[model samples]
Every structure is written in structure tokens, then in C-alpha cells.
Target: MPCLLLAAGRGERMRPLTDTTPKPLLQIQGKSLLQWHIEALVAANARRIVINHAWLGEQIELALGDGAKWGAQIQYSSEETALETAGGIRKALALLNPEPYFLVINGDVFCPGFPIAAFTSRFQAQLSNGNKLLAYLALVLNPPQHPDGDFYLHGEQVNDKPRDADFEERKLTFSGIGIYHQSLFADLKLGEAVKLAPLLRSAMAKNQVFGEKYAGPWHDVGTPQRLYELNQSYDPK
Candidate 1:
């Protein structure tokens, strides 16, 4: 399946740093965060990459070029303004091929050990079995920045409703990594800004969304402080 890397957000939280550079171009260890994701995807043999950029979009093009150096085919989906998540995916759908399912990752996130091949195999199996999942999210333990978390996971399914007061089920954060079916965005209007949560929630109501908890090295590199800490501790190799 083709992959879409979301690199368009104007990093308002990073302020001065993002004033001159896009968040994906921010350095982590010795390499740019976007480069890390690109390398990881390349390693996974996902050579056809579609990146959507809005803030500093040209720089991203200049930095990565045709992706030949990385042994991948790169395509750009330039946006004049940030189109949010769902909208960006909708806009870039054509470049993602005719596959019913494709991978999408947030450009700002840093997940070093994501098992892409394994996840892809599982997703393929689920689809082959005739299951109708609009999307399957990779959930993670809540970080300090978002302690309450986003959704509740029961078994391998996701639900919009929070767990009961008993706290038997733990709420987890959306890791920003997911495999989505094209049908999920079939009703969306192109070029409009639309957040993904509402769409996922709507699908969850019909039991069309699934999830799995991934307990691994993952960080939301939203702020400079987090980036600094990650650089200090992480060895990208």
C-alpha cells in the first residue's frame, strides 16, 4: 500500500523555530524528523510516498527532491493552507494509488520502532476476511501533554464512548499512525478543512473502526522541549 506523510501544519507551538522551518524539517538527533520517517518507510519497502505540505512546502520539496536518493518515488500534494488531516488525505488520494487501504502517518510524530510490515500484514488479513473497517489506529499510552487520551479500546475494536467509571478499560492516545480505507473520505468535499476525529468517531459508532495498543518508543514532537529531550536520549540508528 502507498503511504501519505502529513507535513503541512504550521507549527504554531514551536514558534521561532517553525517561523523559518516546517516541523517535519526539524532536526532529531542527526537527521530531520521527516527524513527519519522517509527512511523508515523505505526500509519497510513502501517506496511510493505521497507527502502533503503547506507550511514551507517548497523547502520540503527542495530537501527531499525526487526521493531517488532514498530509493523511493516521491510525490507532493501542495496545499496553500493547512487542510487538516482528513482533507489532506482526500486531496492526496489520487497519488496514493487505487489501493482500498493505505498508510498515513503524522509528520511531527517520532515513533522509532513501529513494525510497519507486521501492521500491514495484519491489516491485509483483516481486509481479506471481509471485515469492513474504515480505519485501524495504533494506540499508545497517554503522554503528559495529553493525559486524558482520545479513545477507548476494548479487545481489538475502538469505540467513541469512554469506558465506565470502573476504570477497567484504559484510555489511550491516538499514535497518529493508521491504515485507512479510501471509503472513509468518500463523502468529504475536496479542499475543505476537516479534522479526522469526528470522521473516525462517526465510523466507530457503526463498529467500522478498529485499534491496537502499541507499547513502544513513541513521542509527539510538537514542542521544542520534547524535541530537545528526544535528541538527548534517542539514537536514530
Candidate 2:
């Protein structure tokens, strides 16, 4: 399996700071977000990665060259304008993520503890079961900022149906970490922008979307306040 780093957004919510630097290039502690992910993925023995960039994209290429420093091979997919998630994936389909399943991540986040090796087990199971789309969503307990929550979890499946009095409140936020089968993007056309929500909803409707609760600390790392917070708290050993 391969990985795709979704790095192309312009960071509208993250204003003035983003005016100069790409969000992924923003520092958390001493390391850049992109650098941290690169090192972690390489540690997981994930040797190939595809990164799509649009805003301040050129600098990303300059900062992380062929991935030799991190022991991985990197390829870039350029988007003149920010293409929502689906379009970025579609653009990079050929060079990377050509296989059955691949991991996709938002570049602007800090997800140091996300387990990359777990996919090996999931991939084997999907192979045997002939599963078409197996998305391993990273779920989080609701935060004060996002009280509504993103989805509900039933085993590994992500259900849109809110919790009822009869069911346990399995409120979970999409950790921005997910594994996707190439088949998930099957209907997506090339050369067009597409958001991932509707597509995932379609899969969820079919019970093909799965999720996992991640207790580890993950940050959206948006807004100036968040940037200051991460810079103050980030530590890697």
C-alpha cells in the first residue's frame, strides 16, 4: 500500500500565517508537519508517498526533496488551484496509490501516533473478503469546539445516523486519517474537483466505510491560536 498526503489547500481559515507558508510546512515544535509525517511513514516502512500541493506548493518540493533523507521515495502532484480531496487523489492516482488500498492524510494536521502498520491486517482481510472500499477512519471523542461530532461507529462501520436513546453514544470525529481502496474513487472522473464527503457518504450508505477510535492527540493545527498552541506543545523523540 502507498500513502497520499493531501497538501493542496489554501488555508483560508488560517489567514495571515498561511499568507507566507503552506500549512504543512508550518512548524509544530521544531519540526515541520511534513517532515514529521515523512519520518513517521518511513519508520513504518512505507517507502513511497504522493503529495499534492497548490498553495505555496513549490516550497514544499524544495524543503522535502526525493525523500532520500527520510528513506522514502516521494512524488508530487501539482494543482494550479486547490482541488478538494477527491480531485487531489485522482490527480495522483497514476504515480502513487495505484494498488488496491492506500492511506490518505491531510497535510495540515499533526498525527504522530496514528498507527500505519495496522493497514497490513486490514488489507489482507479485505483481499480475502473481496471488499471494494475499505476506509479506516480515525475517530476521536468530540472536542469542545466541534460538539456535533462527525459520525457514529458501529464496529468498524461509520454510520451517519445519530445515536438514539436505544444505542450508545459513539460520537467520533474523523481524525483526517483514512485508508482507501482504489475502488472508492472508481466513479470519480479525472480533471475535475470533487469533495470526499458525498463519496464517503455513498460508501457509508453501503456499509463499506469503516472507522476506528484514536485516543492519541491529533491537531487540526488551523488558526493562529492553534499554531501557537502546537508550537508550544509539540515534542518528538
Candidate 3:
């Protein structure tokens, strides 16, 4: 499956650091967040990677040209204004519209390892059932900074259940990682500033949104403090 890395956010929360360098270019343990993602994706044998850029976008292109160094080909989706996650994906669909299903991820998140086989297996199986799955969300424990959390996990589904109170407590934050089928945004007008939460919620109502719990080291890396913390965690003895 092709991969689309959403790196166009202005990252308002990560100022000072983001004041100079793009957030995805910020290094964690000597490798840029974008580089680390490229490495992992290549190892998983994902060849075509689409990266979207907005603020300080030139740096991203200058730093990782063509993605050849990482054994992958890169296509950039340059957003003049930082489009929210869904908007970016919608814009890049023409470039990487991975036929049946593909993966999308945040460029700023720092997760050291991702299980590619597990994701591929589930994706293929879900497609065999003749169903149009919207997204296969990866959920994780809520971080200390945002305890309210993002979504609910009932079995393998990730979504909202306003009908039940217990479902609210099943709060699990999105890992900023997901698989997207072209059909998910079939009705979307490209470049429209739209958040995907509503579309995902609609999918959830039909039990089409599947999820997996990944207990791994993942940092939001959206603020200077978070960046510092990640750098310290990767500090070598």
C-alpha cells in the first residue's frame, strides 16, 4: 500500500522550535521525524510515499529529495495554507490514491516502531468482505497533556456512541495513524477545509471503523516541551 504522510500543519503549538525549522524536520535521536517514518515505511516495503507540506515546506523537500535515499519515491502535496489532516489527504488522493486501501499518518508523531504486517493483514481481510471500510484507526492510552482523550473503543471499533454512557469512558486517543480507502472521501470536494471526524463518526455508526490498540512509545511532539522530552528520552547514555 502507498503511504501519505500529513506534514502540512503550521504546528502553532510548537513555536520557537517551529519558528525556524519545520516540525517534521526536527530531529529525534539525530534522525528527522520524517526520516524515521521513511525508514520504517521502507522496511515495511512501502515504496510510494506522498508527503504534504505547508509552512517551511521547502525545507522538507530540500531535506528529503525524491525519497530515493530511503528506497522510496516521494510525491509532495504542497498546501499553501496548512490543511487539516483530512483536507491534506483529500488533496493528495490524486497523487497516491491507493486503489483499494492505503495508509495515512501524521508527520509530527514520533512512534519508533509500527507493525506493518499486522496493518496489511487486517486491511486485506477487511477488503475481502466486500465492505468499504473508512479507516482502521490505531488507538493508544491518553497522554498526560490531553487526558480527555479522542475516541471510544468497543471491541475493535473506534468511534462515538452517544447512546451509552459507558462508551464515553472507553476513551482512547487516536495514534494519528490510519488506513484510508479512496472511497472514504469519495464525496469530498478536494481542497475543502473539512475535518474527518464527522465522516469517521458516520462510518462508526455502521461498524465500518475498525481499530487496533498499539502499546508503543508514541509522543505527540507538538510543543517545544514535548520535543525536548522526546530528545531527552532518546538521549544515549
Ranked by lDDT, top first: 1, 3, 2
Local accuracy of candidate 2 as per-residue lDDT tens digits, 111-168? 8877777755664575577665557677887766777888889876787886477856
Candidate 1: deviation at residue 140, Å?
0.3
Badly placed stretches (over 4 Å) of model 3 are: 129-132, 162-168, 235-237
Give per-residue CA lDDT, model 1, range 1-237, as digits (tens).
899999999999998899999999999877888888899899999989999999989999999998999998999999999999999999999889746889999999999879988888887777787878999999999999999899999877888686577676668999999999999999999999899999999999999998788998999998989999998989756
lDDT of 3 by residue, 84-109 (tens): 87788889988996776889888999
Q: Between 1 and 2, whose lDDT is larger?
A: 1
CA lDDT scores, all candidates in order: 0.91, 0.82, 0.85
> How many residue pairs clash in all the candidates, one count each?
0, 0, 0
Query: Which pairs of residues clash in candidate 3, taking residues 3 or more apart in a chain or in different chains?
Result: none
TM-score of each: 0.96, 0.92, 0.93
Q: Return the top candidate by lDDT.
A: 1
lDDT at position 124, candidate 3: 73
